[model samples]
Target: MELTRIGEAAGQRQTPEDLRRREDSKAANNMVTPQEAKERGITWRVAPPEPQVCQFCGQPIQPQGIVLQNMVFLWRPNVRCTCEKAVAYWQEYDRKQAEEKARKEDEERRRAMQSRIDRLLGNSGIKKRFQQRTFPNFRTDTPGRQKNYRVAKEYADNFAYHKAKGDGLYIEGTNGTGKTHLAAAIALQLISEGIPVICKTSSDLLLDVKKAFDNEGVTEAQVLDAYKKVDLLIIDDLGKEQCSDWSMSTLYSILNDRYEDMKPTIVTTNYNTDGLINALTPKGFDNTKIVAIISRLRETSTVMTMAWEDCRGK
Candidate 1:
């Protein structure tokens, strides 16, 4: 009966903390020494009879040494009543409970990570068609292609270093030279690693601002903040956009804010430095305006010219 109380007590509807407190209280009460028991006039036996019956289940309780506690030992120490069936049941129950808890925690973590990745990628402005671009699939056939690949890989690998210095890449080449591929690859990798990145064609960048200005539900400041404050901003097809005074001013403002804040930016272009200046600046507009944009673009970035054959036609 005494030995079986452990299982009986455990089966009670008490909270775990209450159960622990009850067990601790029981231990404190039963810790009387032989002399103390004698002094307290409590009847005691050093050795109890063998094979005591479990009061509830009728299983034989084995006698361990004289500990002056439970199991008909003239006092009480409620050992668990575990016949073979009960022992196996409790062990399996505990194992399953632990496994279920761990599984739930792992699933929660996975869901949270996926949510963050989605938000980052969605806000990154990477087009749906280029979503799957990655460094591993980029072909490096010729010398220039190989050099571009190496440099892009290094940039991505050491992104934290470049990001700190507001350093970026100026990729200039003809169409289908893997320029956009490498830039998209960089953005995808960083987003996967939980970094915030924005990749947009220069045209789309201006278009977004124009939409905000035209009261498309979002404010002009909000759109520009996203462009200026993101960890890395990639402006694709720089000189391809239809240039206007407003477009040049908007580009300069975003670039200037990012530059002053030490935020990194990547630019890809079909035109060389002088050609880009010419394309962005409208006819008869001050050369200094375009020169300022070029100056910052050149000074803040590592100029990489992709002179390889068109990758698309290949």
Candidate 2:
């Protein structure tokens, strides 16, 4: 009956005494126990004390021996197992890696688009034409000039006023002074702020206007447009442009347009108001129009006279 019970528990295949005898016989011959088997790096399973068989292979196992089968929890408790921990760690790492990759790609794309826009704006025909046709580097660094000036704070204040207010400036002094440098400095400031500016010597501008008139395809309107639309217009050596009938009219038109639109202009000249009037009247531009332009500019502008030696020469 004991054998039958053992056989029934072992699926009617083996008796408990038989199995014990076999295990005892094997132990006498120095056979390994289940725990010893596991210590010896062997795979095994242990049976319950109540005559239970191995759930996986249906073999009978000794109660005190280690049954080395994979342990699976129906519900997780406390810390995760090795396999679960490894998988979780890998999942989080991969998610963060993907996010980092996506962010880099977005940043690269934005930079590329910005570069394209800058290229388009910088390479426009209008911009190129202005560079080639207009005076180059006429404005020197103003902050440096302000520092060089003995009354730097005062000069800087005057410059800042014109820059912020978009007011016209009249810089009067003898030749070879720093009038042009100051004017250039203001122009640079405005340009850096994304304001469009045109800096030209009076002689060069007059010559260009004359050439534009003489040339078949060029019109006075084209020249006038470039001058009128700029935020700041700097005319250096103002009394030095070759005055003629067409040049005077062109000058009048530019000044009138700026005056009406409240655009700022900076004139650096060796001549005073009276000198300018005398020069303008000779070309049939009356004093009334000249006075109007000067008055408007004076009302909205600040004048700074530099009587020192030319810093350029120094």
Candidate 3:
């Protein structure tokens, strides 16, 4: 315990010989200055190793090209002079090495993530025509149009919060009013951030399910799972699809599952609630189920009316 206390008290302090060497290092700056030497605490070497001049600071470096000066290397560490450059050089070398290693690791992670995102976007059903849509490109010519833009942008930005509540956007407008444009823009923004969003017209959604039944090598459950479980599912042109009992039922199934799972769903439509009801009212079609779906949508979505003049009407 006495030896432990002495060692602890001497922690990190230069020995007397090392201190004397630095105190007189000015006189013999470029040549090996002969001094009393000791090896290990119990053994002494007959002579010191040969010295060389440092290329960095032009000072007499430690003997025998010794580079290791760092602590925690208790056996035969190079105890350096104050003006030695190897310490600083190795420090900088370690810093650059750590930075380079971090950069390469980050790039590898980014490439892997990008490949995964490519597969997701390809399967997202976002058409190439709308791939270029973005918030900055959206026109805000009027107060109403500006409000629509603000709402859409805010929704996309705060999507994680709304998604937590299963809340989404219900875009209502006439054709050519840029409803789908705003929806696609939101999807693209989320996609660029690596969020999993699936944008498809309801017709194409039904058609994909139909194809899955034929030879697509996929099951109906798989199709429904994708739509029902995506982070955000944008169903564009909701009422434009030619509705059948089966098609509407399938749509309801997807929406219902998404609702139960508390997943957000964005729907763009050229129809009001009544117009949507009328559009869905086919010959002897069941109205009860469609009304329930609309009610749920009203509860879970923020209604954004984009009835302003078409910004593209130039």
Candidate 4:
């Protein structure tokens, strides 16, 4: 018991010299004396130094003119009096300025990234040659016929089928029923995935083909080649083109070539199957050729019918 008590007492007691040494070590580590800082050429002034006399105008020095100066030269006096609070305020200001600068740089970087994405979506022709000839004008914010006319799940399935390099699609729907929207949506989605797509109205395409024929030396074969080779082609508003030997024959040739190659083509027509057959068969062209083209198209394409009540006014 006595030995234990003695040991406890010894542990509790510390010599005054030892205590002094500990304090000295801590002070040495933390102390920043003005005299030492002056030798190091660091000045932290909280206010202006007292003028022995004004250098510019002869005047007696005032006590209020003497400002406190730290060893670090970070703080300067606003007025003549030494005030540590002023130094604290200036430090806070500098910290805020640094934060603001960092935030601005971050915002600028975000804007630059968004700009690159926009360029890729809007103007870059990196996907394929077909993208160079067509512009996508669909907007997500358009305020009419909001519901998807194409059943979303089935449409997605069909999209997957085409995307897998399987075959083409045929969309049957009435006007104002979002058939064009579905076609545009598919094209836009493919574009995002780095695939090339060409979208053109059927009537406009026929007119262009007609113009190519009318201009001497410009063979329609070149135009037909362009139509036949794209990754995806969307022929919108079919059965609306003027029926003629050249128009019917040209359309059949493009469709037949794409069918044989197993390339995908999406056609949205207001006409039903019977009407389409009749339009393709219109008196002048060979009926067997028209039948053959339609048969090949049916063999390689999945036909989807989109039916929705007109919702433009409501």
lDDT on C-alpha atoms for all candidate structures: 0.79, 0.58, 0.76, 0.60
Q: Which ten residues in a row have the lowest lDDT in candidate 1?
A: 63-72
User: In order, how many clashes per candidate?
Assistant: 2, 4, 0, 5
> What overall lDDT, based on C-alpha atoms, would model 1 receive against the true structure?
0.79
Give the alpha carbon lDDT tens digit for every residue of 1-314 in model 1: 98689878778768989889998887666655445555666554554435567655787655333334332255344344677766776688789999999978856764554454344333568988898878999887778888999999999999989998999999999988999999999999987876777889999888878877677556778777778777788999998898888888889999988888988999999998889999999776776767887788789999999866666955
lDDT of 3 by residue, 11-32 (tens): 9677898789986674333223
Sort all candidates by lDDT, best to worst.
1, 3, 4, 2
CA shift at 235, candidate 1, in angstroms?
Answer: 0.2
For 22-110, candidate 4 gives per-residue lDDT tens digits of 88786444444344455656455553344344332344433221113424433222232234554566677789999999878856754
TM-score of each: 0.61, 0.47, 0.62, 0.48
> For this target, which candidate reaches the highest TM-score against the unseen true structure?
3
- Looking at model 4, residue 140 earns an lDDT score of 24
- Once model 4 is optimally superposed onto the true structure by TM-score, how far is the C-alpha of residue 272 displaced, in angstroms? 1.7
Which 10 residues in a row give candidate 2 its minimum summed lDDT?
71-80
lDDT at 19, model 4: 94
Distance (Å) between predicted and true CA of 283, model 1? 2.1
Any residue pairs clashing in model 2, and if so which?
44-68, 45-67, 46-67, 139-184
- Native RMSD of candidate 1 (Å): 15.3
